[model samples]
Every structure is written in C-alpha cells, then in structure tokens.
Target: MFSDSEIPFDVIQAYLETHYHVHGRAPTTLQVGEANALLAALHETAGVACSAFLTACNPFSQQLEPPRNLELQEALAESLQQRGLRFIGGIGQHPANGWPGEESFLVLGLALDDAKALGTQLGQNAIVWSGADATPKLLLLR
Candidate 1:
C-alpha cells in the first residue's frame, strides 16, 4: 500500500491519459479540474500529505452554463457531505502554471474507496497510480 504522497504527478498524468484513451474521449477541463480537486480532498480527508495539483477557474465557464454549473457543484458538495467528506472551495492563481486568472473550484476530501464510489456514481473513472512499484488501478464508473 502506498501513501498519497508516494503518488507521482507523472503517474497521475499517465492514468489521466489512459482514461482518455480507454474512454475514447478526453476529460473536459472541468473534469480534469474536478479530478485533481477530488484527489486533494481525498488526501486531506485521510490526513495524508496531498500531492495533488489544484487550480482555480471561473465557476461559470463557457463549457457549462450558470444554473447547470451551480447545480453540479451543489450536487458534488452534497454527495461528498453525505459521504462524510469535507468540501474545500477556493479562488487563486493556477497552482500548476501560476497563470494570472482567478477561478473557483470545489474539492472533497475522500478515501480511495470513497473516491471510487463517488466516481462510479458520477459515471467517471477513478484512475490512480499508487506508486512506482505497483500497477495502476482503474476504477470504471458507468
């Protein structure tokens, strides 16, 4: 078993790519952001060191309209809350590139199992690479 800190960004990126390839579609910007946020939340909830990268973005982007985006955020929050996870929201410069843009994001701290369950519920794949020594695990949500 590997700790969250042991997971590398390259590993995560690889799985993310695999997710794209296997699904025959790349995750939307929103999905990428959400996945990162979820990973961060999971680490926080587990009291483990969170190495996940996070970014902020406009809550209302062109990809999603106002009410729908708001609804999605609310639904994700409610789901996490019901699962005993804490949601963290923030607005800041992009953590990865230090881009000069203020954005909003919601992250729910969850354990691996909880993350998998949530992904399943949302029709997403929770792909995680535990460590260099372990094989990547893909949890399909359909």
Candidate 2:
C-alpha cells in the first residue's frame, strides 16, 4: 500500500481534499485532513500488499477513485486521450491528472517523488504548477 509520504505532499493533499467522502462532487479543500485519513484507510483495506500503483483506491469505493476524479474526470480524459493514456473503461480512473490547469500535483503515471522532480528537471511549463500553493498535508482514515 502507498503511504502519504509515497506521493508528493501537494497532490496527496489534493487527492485527499477532493476525493474524500465525495458524492459525485469534488471535496472542498478544507477537508484535506479527512481525505488523508480516507486514503490511509483504503490502503489498509486493500491489504497494503504493495501492488502496482497502490490501486489508488478501490474503484468500488468512493475514497480512492483515481487521479482524474469526477471533479476533473473530463479534463483528465482529454489529457489521457491527448497523451495516449487511452480510454480503458472499467479500469477505474487513471492514476493521475497531467493537465496544465488541473495539475494538482506531479504528472500522472510517475511516482510522487518523480513527479515532483519533473518541474525542476524540465521547466515551469513542463510540470504541474498550482498558481496558488496552499497548505501541505497528509491524512489517514478518520
């Protein structure tokens, strides 16, 4: 299973903030802590066996929906399509979102640490940059 430390703090927070307890809606940023908790719980529930991509979250569950979440699924789809991520329906959301505007964290597919380095390795436009940086956080289940 992936721990919060495993991913970039910002993207982790973005995942937690938006995906936690969502009901067809993006979670408010204020609930970031709650989101973190949900991620931890999902990891544990998944047996923490260290599988590929950490399963993000069970497709059946609301917590770990995917990087291209409902809030940004449309945008994510466009990105995947453009990037050749392809539409593999029934596989659940892609592991990440790489859109310039929606890049909540590191790029998709790459580990959090790797994503973090992308910006520095390449350039500002090459990576996900939040116009406004907010609090950095990690969450476990409630």
Best by TM-score: 1
What CA RMSD would you report for each candidate?
A: 12.2, 13.9
What is the Cα-based lDDT of residue 71 in candidate 2?
Answer: 43
lDDT of 1 by residue, 1-142 (tens): 2235334555344334432111112211222323444343344454654221122122211244445545765676565567664444533332354333332333323345655554445433233322111222443332
Per-model TM-score versus the true fold: 0.37, 0.23
Tens-digit per-residue lDDT, 27-90, candidate 2: 3222322223422333344333111111222221234334535445455445545764312222
* Model 2 residue 125 CA deviation in Å: 12
Q: How many clashes (backbone atoms < 3 Å, residues ≥3 apart in a chain or on different chains) does model 2 have?
A: 6
lDDT of each: 0.36, 0.30
Give the local distance difference test score of model 2: 0.30
Tell me the lDDT of model 1 at 140: 33
